[model samples]
Target: MNIYLVYWNSLNKFCFRGILDESIGEGTHFLIPWVQKPYIFDIKTRPHTFSSISGTKDLQMVNLTLRVLSRPDTAKLPVIVQNLGLEYDEKVLPSIGNEVLKSVVAQFNADQLLTERPQVSALVKETLVRRARDFNILLDDVAITHLSLCWKFVTGGNCQRCLEDAVTRIGSSCRKKEDGRALNSGCYLRHSPHKFYNNSSSNDVAAGNRGHRKMAIILAASSAVLALLLVTATMGFFIRKNVMRKRRERKQFGTLLDTVNKSKLNVPYEILEKATNYFNDDNKLGQGGSGSVYKGVMPDGNTVAVKRLSFNSTQWVDHFFNEVNLISGVHHKNDERRKNTYTSESLRQRFNRDSGMHS
Candidate 1:
């Protein structure tokens, strides 16, 4: 029991232990064996978040998650114990929070709450802090953790801008890569084998309303005609420019391929399946909860351990690659050191005429 030292009388052999008289922050406190009675009160920060349904100024019913951080006032401990007691959170705080949230939300429209979250949160915190002091509680902060509107409105202008930026920027920058994705605040661009497209159907609908596809085709056709005329007018200059551009592109491709080859640690699934004879039971090396390991022989007579990871083992994929990268770095460093040592030893042997004569 958490008992503060209140009044102790040795002559009468009576002790009073209560939260009202003295302040005890936290920890175990031993009381007089029989005469003392103990009363405990928790003095820790309390956090609570609950969903509240409130009507906005625009008559829209919105659900918001109201979060409150508070603690009992150390100076007003006696008042807190005498009046509110332990059931304050259940009986008092929730109702006060609900009322304050409704009053604050009724002042703003749903759009204001959505667009100006910081201002709304600050107002709630200020109002709640003042009110909590009356109940002998110190309010730390208040926040609208989440706000959900009854309906969502998609802006056509934002989606159009996102699509234009992605198409013009990602297409030109990531043209050579087979697959990639670009993300923005409002929309995302996804690339597959076919082409880049908006991940959100809403964005596609919005952009389509502007006739972007038709405009693109029209521009392409017009550009092709213009290019044909220009080439006819300056054939030699255009040809020379195209040749130089092709040469530069070839050099870039070679550099990229070389870099990729250095870190090529992936094996095709189909090849692994074929090498293990379609994961025959006879070729299985071990089996466990996370799936089986198999022994496979490559065409070059090199044996490899192929793991058939379970579908549920997806969480380990990142860890597997991390360990692989670390091991690769260590091996690469060791290879470089060995190469340098061999080169140094060979040069020393070649230059040492005394050692050669002794040999």
Candidate 2:
């Protein structure tokens, strides 16, 4: 029969055939048979107690006494023998314990750890369990055995004094309430009419002040609306004035154009050609009743629309000027009748010219 002592180590797995060496330490090691071999293991759960000082969320120093129970898994013995040689505890346990304690204590304050021991213990246990899981080890329990404040290190005075004062106040109040004379006299239940009336009057005054404030707010809002209306009206008046001024200027320009056209009526054909780009298609803007309107730019950079009338037209130049004057007079009155009449006459003349029907 072949016997073997399989054990775990930090670096490699170890297997000892036959009996194990008794002199070897609490780690996995080899042994031989008959000559001298007895396997001894430090399989017992290791207890580690350490003191750690850390800060809580509120930046207070906390003193913690932590106890950790750490041991390797028996089921993982085969893997441990194959992977890590004997001496896993020395390599793994110390570092794991330190990390677990620090991580657990970081979540709590000194006062909470002292008062709520169960919660702190749960946190420590959870930290150790999670850390050990990665190593294939079992963390039995992590206990917070002791937690206290070092007042001299943290604060100048003793915390016991404050606790004593609170206890004294509670005791006195309880004793006074239990006394028969104090209960019968109703000293604690004394009523004041003046205080009641004053509170009532204050409430009424507050209500009235609220109503006044609401009215003031409403008045202020109305004044703002009125001011806006006045500003809008003033802007509208100025805008209308500007529009009317532009229309008057356009009318005066039209009258001046009519006068210039009249003066050019006696000018020869050659002069008209030089003035209107030889009646070129590029210079033409539109065709109207009297003639074609051409867009022309003078040497002075002024743009003008040149209207060229056809030759041998029966209507004289005076008749066209009279019609233009009549349209301008009605434009200031804002009447649609005169404008419609002018447009109708222009349309009739254009139709006659295009259809080759004279007169």
Candidate 3:
């Protein structure tokens, strides 16, 4: 089952009798179980951050964070495994990166380091790229994400650089590994009357901080205003929709009342409820496909026929309103009973014919 394992986007190291042989490309390559073994290497490009503390030429300690985009060089996979094994980048990048950074940074002064950042980055990347070729690791990109002065930096008088150099020399005496490179007094400023650090630099940094704070505040205010506008628009949309729906309902009620006024058939629901005993089945005289007809006693003790429409059909609403409109202008030939059990079919037919509809 392991022999038929599927793999993609990976490099496989094919070995015979547990000996490092050759690297293979992506695909299923079955092994001979005990005789053959394959080591898989994920050849995906990923970023590695390298942190190193190195002094600038002006003797101010600068901390550097190097972001290196790397992947295993496919052609050199066997050599990579033999040399540094699976954790090749971890073994090689930090050593080379620190060496390259310290060597490159020692050539530039602290003032030039801040002012000429692009040239500094290019030089570091070029040096790292050249050094990485021998390690079988391909560098896609190299960048200095952070370049900052140490927080422990202090400034005093005209002899500040010299004092700083002597103090660093004293501090490096306790460390054995970095003892050789620690006292890097590649000092740019010598016995000069100028201060190594000044008040104006602090003011500039404070101004930059203020500008960033203002930008963040403006961004937050803009986001809040935009959110408020969005909520207002949403609320206005729903409110206007509700108002329009209510207006439409009012218009429909007004129109129904105007049409019923023409036929003089504006009987209130309570009066009809009382007259028909709340639509009791006993009061129902006849039933048809459209509705039921009920006999009712009016307020003047006169007999009346009330038709109740069947609301089960979706077309009932349209049919009910249309019938009222038809009856509104209709004139019967008989001119007889005002309240009858049946509608005037002949008059209704004439109204439908005049109105250009059969029923």
Highest-scoring model, TM-score: 3
Q: Best to worst by lDDT, what's the order?
A: 3, 1, 2
lDDT (tens digit, per residue) of candidate 3 on 1-359 = 35545353333443533444557777776666555656677888889998999988878899999999988888788788777877888889999999999999999988788899999999999999989997878899999999887534445553477557765765555444323323333333222234445589889999999999999999999999999999999999999998997677446545644554566544555566678897789999998656677877878797666776554332433676655455445677642245222223332443334432111
How big is the RMSD of model 1? 34.9
Clash number for candidate 2:
8
Q: What's the C-alpha lDDT at position 243 in model 2?
A: 95
Per-residue lDDT value at 265 in model 3: 48
- Report the C-alpha displacement of residue 120, candidate 2, in angstroms: 1.0
Q: TM-score for every candidate vs. truth?
A: 0.37, 0.33, 0.41
> Which scores greater on TM-score, model 2 or model 3?
3
What C-alpha RMSD separates each model from the true structure? Answer: 34.9, 19.2, 20.9
**Residue pairs with backbone overlap in model 1:** none
The CA lDDT at 181 in model 3 is 29
**Residue 2 local lDDT, model 1:** 35
Regarding lDDT, does 2 or 3 come out ahead?
3
Q: Candidate 3 versus the native: TM-score?
A: 0.41
Candidate 3, poorest ten consecutive residues by summed lDDT? 350-359
**Model 1 poorest 10 in a row by lDDT:** 336-345
Residue ranges of candidate 2 with Cα displaced over 4 Å:
1-40, 78-85, 152-359
Candidate 2 residues 1-359, lDDT tens each? 23444452222223434322223334444433444434334556887777777666556666767777777775564454445546665666567766766777677765666677787788778877887777767777778776755442333244445445555654555555532111221112222333433577888999999999999999999999999999999999999998997676446545644555554333333434555677688988888665566765545455555565443332333445554464447544334331111132343444345532111
Q: TM-score rank, highest first?
A: 3, 1, 2
